[model samples]
Target chain A: MPQCSNCQFQNMPGTTHCGRCGASLLLATALIDVHPPRATRWSKTWRKSRFWHIWHSLNHLSADLARRVDVSYPSSWPSILAAVRLIVPGWPQLAGSKVNLGRFLLGGYLSCGLLAAVCYGTTIGSFFIAVAITIHSIGLYDVAQSSSKVRAVRISRILLGCGLIGLFLYLPLFNLVPQYAAPFAIRVNREPLRVGDVLLSNRNAYVWARPRVGDIVLYELNPVRVPAFEQGRNAVLNLAGQRVDRVLAVPGQSIVCDGRTLTVDGQPSPHRPLNLTFSSLQVSLIVPPDHYFIIPSGERIDGLLPNNENIVRTLSLIPITQIEGRVYWRNYPWSRMGRIR
Target chain B: MARFRKLELGKGLPGDSNPDGPSGNEQAGCLELAVEQRRCGNYENALRLYSRALEDDKSLVTGWLGQVQMLIMLDESVEAELWSRKALELFPGNGDLLAGRAQAFRRMGDKGQALLLSDGALKSAGQSAYRWMVRGELMIVIGQETHLHCFDKAVQIDQDWLVPLEIALIYRDLGAPSRALGRIRRTVELAPDRYYAWFVQGQVERDLGLEAAAIKSWRHCLELCHGHVDAERELAQLEAGGWSVGRVWRRLFGNR
Candidate 1:
């Protein structure tokens, strides 16, 4: 069935005009299949091929691994290998007949190399090191191949690659690895973090030191500790994931958030007061042993907290056991990136 | 069937600022494609197409509306406000633009400004269903008791499934899952194949603790629109068997 482009009315198949509106349905054909199902066998293969294309662009072995079964078992291994070579480095004579994989591969290699270098230079040290090593090996192999290119051209390419690679590797060698690693990179999806911004948390920063008031920490939410009512209502409350929040108080402290003002241990705290969009939540408790009270970094924290009283109570004082790491830096959006206070 | 509703769309709010129907050229085609993309939740692509459409025909009110609506969905209320004000400059006293500006103000937490703008929008809205829906949403945000009546008016203007869907969502947010469920049931009856209706039904059922029913509704939603993200997430949570008391205790007591 086609949907009316003008009125959005779903019309019967083969109808010249919308049943509800008299608009011609000719243009409605494009709107009929908005989201095609991806579970089909053809789509699965297409997805796999797309993944292979990315891996191939990076010159990673994963692409080769993906093709090994078809390559190794094929009766035309020699022809296939030759085809692969020609497809990647299509001669100018075959420009119209063949895909210019050579241009694509070169572009992909340089971009991926730059990305991996930046990733390593920032905080993703281990993963980028492995990627850097793999790409360098591929570069060295290209330089070694006599059939590939002129000696001068290969040497210059390798030198450029080596220079960029060395710059990235220098940080790790000098004990200058970034203080935090951003394993959770989706903080930009929320407020305070703009698109292209990345959050970096130090897993060991709080291990030796005590987390104090005003520190943003990553903590795990234990659903079981959440009251049964909340778990039944919204299952995400208990889902295991590292969440970032500002620590409000520690053990033996009394805290109060009156929707407008927040006071801790009889002193007014310096922080934005909660927005009273929902029912005002009031909590005053002696922080129990091994518990830390943390609040999310948003003006309106109502939807951020679970609805059940027991869950809210449990969340109000996060057990030290659930504390994962301390968020310390905004690593991306270079213009605004800096140490998070 | 009554499922087919007479729609005087893109005309109700702000008195049809675009007196010219459309250039009926490539720009109109682009606008149509942009609307299709927006409806499908392909926001980034829709934005690009909307901009293209606007570049060719700046007077196209729907293009401006789509841009403002997409900005709101992206949680960029500041940008939404800027764009709405720009549209208002071109089409002054346009009700849709005024309502869209109200939405941006509401999101920015300025309830007073939002209410004033929304009230002004209602005066010029005439019978625009989308404008009435926006007014109803603002009413809910301001905690007004007449929000439901606004939603009713929206539905009364045009019996589109979207009006009911919007009403159901508001009810769900107000902690009245039963009411949401009732409205969503009517939406499903009106548009049985609409994935969003089933998805909202599943949500209301989940809130009501009807796990089995929720799962059934979500499964149907996925069947209708395969790989729907929300439905997929809901199904995964249900399949994971939820949290147990012992497991929670272990997490709370275990030292990392």
Candidate 2:
């Protein structure tokens, strides 16, 4: 029986036309050859190049391994590709053909990252960064689950994958997050930074810029032995720790403070140490080239010492290197949460 | 009123000729039945029969080959590959078994291994239609121009209508409808009585965008094999305005 190519109406073997559609039965079958074009001279030369040789070898090696494992599952290749693209959250999901989930994850990841960057030195920024990392980790796990050939993935492989991703994320973020913003808790009562108050300090605040006057700076102090009235006994207390203070004078400036009134190079200065009462009636100093004049917060050191001149001088001049960071924002005690003035 | 006939004890009823229970030709009968079931596209039934035949005679290479081929047709390529390896260990360097394994690998998406095993099949001995068909499929996968020549060689080796039909199916599966049409035309001309050939012709024509031709082909197929569900569904889909939006989307983007 001969079937019409146009209408597929069966007819006699020797018929010239279809009985139903009236189309010709003897039409030649059009052969559409899909043979690839012959290699050109440039292509031939490129195929012999070192890079191409390496690529070809790698291709052969991977094909051999795939054959050995019999990786024939429908999602195997996509899963593998997704694993490789795990650097970007939701990229693996997209590669593995989970389009909607991938898009949602990618959008969330990017939005969180943008927010973290925008709110770089705040508590909310840290929260956003944590959220972004969590999204990325979830994407990785999803890709791994989808790619696994067995229903129950091997415990060791899962652990290894997670460990590697954890290390990759931890290494950079461990250094980066603190450099931008680090949390500090006030231990003693100060005017603005009272006990139990949590604040954030920008550790990289003075990396490229100099600390200016009126900026509240956190700096380390040398050990000072101060007499303490503990249990009705005169006991010495070693004070060697970090302190937050206000910079009243920068390099090449002179500051004079008499009890309550203060002067910076013959002009009255508005910046004052919070909750501090100076014991010395006349205290004057010239800020050096690489130092700043800062009034340490809390009880004045002169009031605690019998001979307080040495301790005062030690506390007044703050070297640039010893300045740790700038106090930026108060995060805890929601009622008082705001930027530190 | 009807009376019941009396039953005999030693001598059974008139149609009960075989006095003995099991015969020596049981394994051969199983293989024959398996072939018939395979020809009818009952791959599961054929696989069961093939397994029965293998149990009776473990050394039967044809039974092993039949089982492997049935598994591949049933889309159990992993099992097929494993069984092929076990069979290969029993009958080392068997060309037909090698060709069967190559087909399994091809189904499993390992074209590189398929091509390698196909080459080994051709190199081993006994030129058969199956080995040539595997080579043609490998060529098609790699986009070689000589695929048509390989299919021609397969048809030349065996003039059975099943050969061209299988080739057409391979071409269809690999997304070469035009090439499949040429082989399907040969198949229909060779076996006009085979309803499946007409059904496949309808599918190929539909793939080529010849809606009228596909309808006529499906109608002819239904005439030969009445109440065929696949043919009826295809005809209904065509009559109801083919290519729904979702269908088109799946066709364009689905893994298939």
Candidate 3:
């Protein structure tokens, strides 16, 4: 007869599932007693063997360690090992014999982590990373609870284990997300911001401080309609993307430019366009409120719309809300790694 | 030591034989000796004997059942459950093996499963004192008043002194020392020479606060089983007047 591990039902011979409880009998194995029987001559001889001596020694070591740790019944070295196995999220759950939940958590954590990695630096990636962290945290809590039957021991273990995990794993990722601090790789060559130089941007910089002249800023470009010749008819093309540039003028300042030389409030400005080359031009305007004059990076606005004042105004003036972050450090290309000027 | 003896309740004495005694055969003698060892509270020895008997004769259902019962007595409920399943494989639908598995489940705290298995045991082919006793234990676990009727049915099925002794042991464990005293006294009357009975009787008397009767019972138990460590310990504790406030509180209302 095969016994159902779930309900302990004794089914007839050769039964695949339990007749009473319908639990599958194929995977059910009988529980074996680990305690040795009373010592007899045969048993004594067996105990004297090298295998028995090692096993006995290991048991004693685990018991001693458990006692030293104040972990009572069910908190042997195996349970502690299970708690430590939280590195893989669901490994501890599997060690604690929660097979179904362990598999689900492991699958979820791995899948979410893989997706987050594949879609790194996007909103979707951050969402997946958050989900993965939540799953890992749940696994940690589960392992801690299963580590001991004592309430105080379980709670203490949960706090200590979760605290360490949060410190090492969650905290760094939490700080990185939500525009706290973000890494950006410079793809185009712009002086001081060369290609392959990775910059760290403090997204929270302008939260309390105002954007000042000479500060490198990361800002989103609003879509603009540009005339395009398509299929022999004039078509409107939408152009939008992000750009990193230096602030040349602040709000309420008067900016005057004659092609190359730039002046702000009747004085020559120290800031130069980071992406655009010096050219002959004539422009004079008062910086609008809540807007900063930023040099467009490598954009030939005059050539795109010759003599179009609207294009120059739209390209030069950036709103305060558009300022995404302050570039603080150039982190990549080992030789040039330092705080951004 | 007293706790161990309270469970035994002289139910393991050699003379209080199992009603399902071994059949007259070559391996019967080994099984009979195993039964005697089990009666004498030497469950490990009894288990080894049963294994030896099974090695010689695999068809002997009693040998398998005895192994399972001994494991349960030794508080190896997991081994009992496994062994019972293995035995059931050989003798499928055997009522006694089902009851043994039920007892294992009960000890393992699976009361619902235990009740389910016990019901199957009762409806199976053969009826035995062990099966009724398991049902009675299940009843007691559920706080049913009909537990006594179930135990009485077990006693009626098997006239051995072991039946009442085991019933008294169960009663005492469930914190009904008053009810246990009657059954234990009957056990002592039936088996006067069994020192384990007097030991259990003393434990029940002590639980009821009958210090004088408990002392007398322990003395008699020591005389029958000379140098019995548990009996001597009980007498020593009594002589030293070691009843503490906590012990008194436990005696009065700990069961509740």
Clashes per candidate (backbone, < 3 Å): 2, 0, 7
Candidate 3: regions farther than 4 A off: A1-341, B1-27, B238-256
Fraction of reference contacts reproduced per prediction? Answer: 0.00, 0.00, 0.00
On lDDT, the leading prediction is 3
1 or 2: which has the higher TM-score? 2
Q: Give the least accurate 10-residue stretch of model 1 chain A, judged by summed lDDT.
A: A29-38
Stronger candidate by lDDT (2 vs 3): 3
TM-score of each: 0.37, 0.43, 0.42
lDDT of model 1 at position B92: 62
What does candidate 2's lDDT look like per residue over B1-256, in tens digits?
A: 1343454357422223444421447667777888877765677788877766665455566777888888777766655776787667556667788999999788666787888899899997568998999899889888898988999999999999889988988998889999999999999999898888899999999999887789789989999989989999998888667556755664579622
**How close is candidate 2 at the interface, in terms of C-alpha RMSD after superposing the true interface residues?**
21.8
B70-96 per-residue lDDT for model 3 (tens digits): 887776665577678767765667788
Best by TM-score: 2
Q: Residue pairs in steric clash, candidate 3?
A: A1-B89, A259-A280, A259-A281, A275-A298, B12-B39, B12-B40, B13-B39
Q: What is the TM-score of chain B in candidate 1?
A: 0.75
